[model samples]
Target: MLSRKNLEILVAAQKRLYCTFPELPSFEQRWDFETDGVIQALLTRLGDNDPYFHPRYAGHMSGYVCDVAVMSYFLAMQFNPNNHSYDGGRATTKMEVECLDSMARMLDWNHYQGHLTSGGTIGNLEALWIHREMGANTVICSKGAHFTHKRAANILDLKYLEVDVTKDGSLCSIALSGLLAALEATDVPVVVCTLGTTLNGAIDPLDEIFSLKAEHDFKVHVDAAYGGYFYLIRARLAGRNRKAFDFLPAADSIVIDPHKHGLQGFGCGALLLRGVSESTSQAIYTHDSPYTYFDRRGISIGEKTLECSRPGAAAAALWATMQCLPLEEEGEFSRVLLSCHTAAVKMSELLFAVDDVRLIVREPALDIVVFYIECADISAATRQLYEQLKASGFYVAMADCDISSETGVFREVSCIRLTLMKKEHLAMVDELADQIIRLSKCIADEYRSQYQAL
Candidate 1:
């Protein structure tokens, strides 16, 4: 449900907006407008869509974006500025710069250069394209990495190689070392490390991957689209995960999605580069485009990105959200993520007591909880649990995982994936776990009855 108080505030602010500009022209935006009926129909159609803001929808690597982002995005679109050129988005471009710097500080970079992209996919594409431009031939990534790296490699026509992951779902440095050692010495491969994988919230060891750089020459690019904001709560995480985030500043390039955990709406992500200098970037951006980049008003962010004509509204939304919830350790936003981690922890503990449940990692490295039904027909039971949960209005996801760890943990089963990403979901986890057990019991009983009759 939309907040009435915020809507009133937005209306009040909108009234004040007209005072700033000369009132030369105005148009009616009431129900009488020609598109109003169509908009009403669209709203009705949207009711069938899944409600992601609700706590029940813990299906995937997404969460409830904050209200401030909605308000800021709506407010900025009134001007409809384009962030491609300097004069085209004088105000928003600076806001985007500030937003980039804020994210840089979160990553512990005192000085850096970056620009916002449409989302993580394009953000990663630009990084790979830059590597290709720098004479890098092949792309090496873990099996757990996002599919975008391989797809981007195909789009750019570069050779792609996949490495093995540890049983804990992290990129195996040993496998990567062997791959790098065997590669032709003349070729420099771009190694893509993941901070948080989409399948399971597994964090690759960033610190260990960089260690291999000296032994074998390769540029390191981090795919933190799902987990970059976890940097804010680095102290909350421990062991391999915490150590991995600490080494983010050492990465050559990083990709993050503000649309996800950053609490902005969709279509907002960023690409941060460490080694690309100002003069070098200028040489890269200065192409033969006559009329587009002629404006000397300020720095145009489009030069830093592969995408053209980016929405300034996304930048405005991010800038405003940062003001409301600054990306800092031990801050309110970090506490939200901490609550999610705690929720996952609680779910893990509760699942242990359930009759037919096996946690994939015992404890989640992040907020994603994975468990399979330990039954004779495990696959069927897992699918039934997923469908019944959705029907019960407690939407969760399913993952087909084949896991093998260094600790001698091995499982090849269809599993349930619970992404308790909302702060509110923390409170309901106990009940959520109860529902899983109750539903699992029914599934097990039904399977038993069928087997006995047969």
Candidate 2:
């Protein structure tokens, strides 16, 4: 009787869902069934409800048409291929491999090996795990690297050294050299440089750090989940027949996220490794279950991967999206990526021009701009600004206190971070600029009134 009641409830819910479909003009709907609104709505809801998902919830996120990714996510769900084994879904995993290879080539290490993980954090963890397991006792990065990098190091029980960054939020090469000299001969150090920071998308000096690989035998891993796509843009604008363009050579291993730049849905990140020999990534498993092993090796994917049973939908979506985007002349991703960088520059210009609000990063390394108002009481003003901006329906990020504190800028500076990914985001920047000006004036008036009352 309870099962029957639940069935009835389910049927009623389905009926309610059906009522939400948009009514369209008959002729257009008949001619363009692909643009059907009902199908799009269904896909959007599925993406929001799925496990291992980042819910967009009708709010602007990272200046992306997240709804589009949601559509791809659901569209790929139809096949439901298990990409664990070639025997089961060889075609799907092969497509995933091709997508991974495209990313590898972009990083300038065609020989690199990698696999898609859940997200950037997972990608970072996998890279660190591989590096640590191979033999890296100590890790080094700028104070501005993402929290996940530090968290991954802590999980591995590894000690990490953080160097100070310049005012532009780049790692100081001189500071890094000094730290290396200070380290004892017995100390083991592996430099993990950030290609793009999370809070403000500040790119560390890749060329300088990579040059150190010759002086020191330490391995270099790039956390390029936020800035890897920038290299492709730099190559494109240089034009044909240009010799020796400025770009970071692919490190020993680098983390890239499809969800961030590849325009695919979330839960898609790859860790490209320069020298991923069989010994470094050999599959070692004790569980000898004959039932699970159907492939040539007869080994389950769980043995090779950190997570068991990763969704094939994410891999499929990534493969499909990469197919849609064509590569550039020098074998890089599409020029559309450069548009995102340009939007970021425009936004930065608008933000810097605002009265009293100072740009934290004057020139952005990627599609991120960070700025703050100069005030004596930074905390109170920042809190007020954050609230006002949020209430205005503009989604921006604040710098982490711990990271800023270590960099010697936390107390003196509290800034907001913006990522420009969508072209529509450019129209909104003027409005944001106006809001900042209004917010600064409001803070000044409040402070002045308090002084007079005192």
Candidate 3:
């Protein structure tokens, strides 16, 4: 049984968070939309309207709470398994193994193998390390790929090749092929394909890149952290055209975040290597232990995992959430996520109507809809708009896109991105939309008046 004091701490933590919520709502709100929506409705009825966005802070997608995630977090704490060694936590490790298998199967890789990591960055580094060990000297990724890819290359001390992404933020296959040919001439190795880019949610052309791999001898790794799970949700909705869903399992290794789309709390992610074998032994550096060895499989998790002393509580939470909500078509969680995609499209449509702001990418590939303030040399004007909206309680940030000039890379573009989630929040979309339109018009008018006077 759990200790009374520990239980009290949990309760106290909840109360404190609730008390401080309005003042400091972290990207992740503990209360579900339904719970908060009811209070919001009541307040609106009473004419005590208040906007929910926190100024100066962007919300993290991993912070959101579903009922299953909350239950998983607590239940895992109860078991308190230490997934380091077999003796310490056999059952918990087995649970993680099953989860890994499910992740592989979901990606359609029957012979795939993977383990949980703290998050996508760790998973990415681990995958890159394995590929580096397998004779990859040069790593190629989209210019818009997460900074972690370059950081991972730095960690390994390898030469990183960044392919200029197309205007939509996806790597062009021809450009990549030319680079690969140039690298091959120089005897370079390895290509890391991006499944979904972080900034604009663009999916790299996997089929074309894989075709290049078939002709050449370079290992491929896919960073599917943000968009991999979309396959399952999109497949169920789109049915026959599931060809796009099949790209995940094709890479030599892949990174998928259970925290991002799995609806679990943060710090729980997985890195999967296709066809893992004894050659890929995870290093062991520990004092002799009775329960360390496993006879069936030569590789224990510690061999492959980057972390040695991680929280099994995260694994237990994920396991419990999986039990409560399966990833099938009929599951409620997938449906909710599908609804989030719908909400994104809805938001995009509304944003389109506002003048002087155009979508960076015409159509969204996932939940992220990116748009920029399309005015010239007007950082001051845009900054003013951002300040006004933030002061009015609408939280958003000026997104940056690196543009290459003769001088080098510069952050010359400014945009606002909306990551839509929760069906209940969709109901408030129009209200938010109206505010954006109103603010944009006001700012444009101010800009025009000032320009004319000057």
Query: Which candidate number maximizes TM-score?
Result: 1
Return whichever of 1 and 2 wins on TM-score: 1
Among all candidates shown, the one with the greatest lDDT: 1
lDDT (tens digit, per residue) of candidate 1 on 1-454:
3479888988988887776666566653666458878999999999997788888889976677687888888888988989998878988999999999999888778878789998999999999988888778899999989899999999998899999998778999999999999998667799999998987789999989988888888899999998888888877886788999988889999999988888877799999998877787777666756768677878888876788899999999999989988887878989988998889888989998876677777778789988877666776788999999988889898888874332244456678999988889899998888899899888878877888988
Q: Write down the worst ten-residue block by lDDT for model 1.
A: 403-412
TM-score versus the correct structure, for each prediction = 0.94, 0.76, 0.79
Q: What is the lDDT of residue 150 in candidate 3?
A: 92
Off by over 4 Å in 1: 23-33, 403-413
Candidates in descending lDDT order: 1, 3, 2
Can you write out model 2's per-residue Cα lDDT over 1-454, one digit (the tens) per residue?
A: 1246545654565455455445933331145446568888897887663122221111222424233344445645655666665555555677767877777666566576677788789888877787788777788889888778789889998888899988767678789888887887866787877766776666677667766666666878888787776666665432310111243554777787777777766677776777768655774223455665467743234446665566677776777666666444343344556665666677677766765566766666666776666555556776788777767665566663322332245543556666666545555656766776788778857766776887
Q: Candidate 1 — which pairs collide?
A: 167-404, 167-405
Better of 1 and 2 by lDDT: 1
> What TM-score, to 2 decimals, does candidate 2 have?
0.76
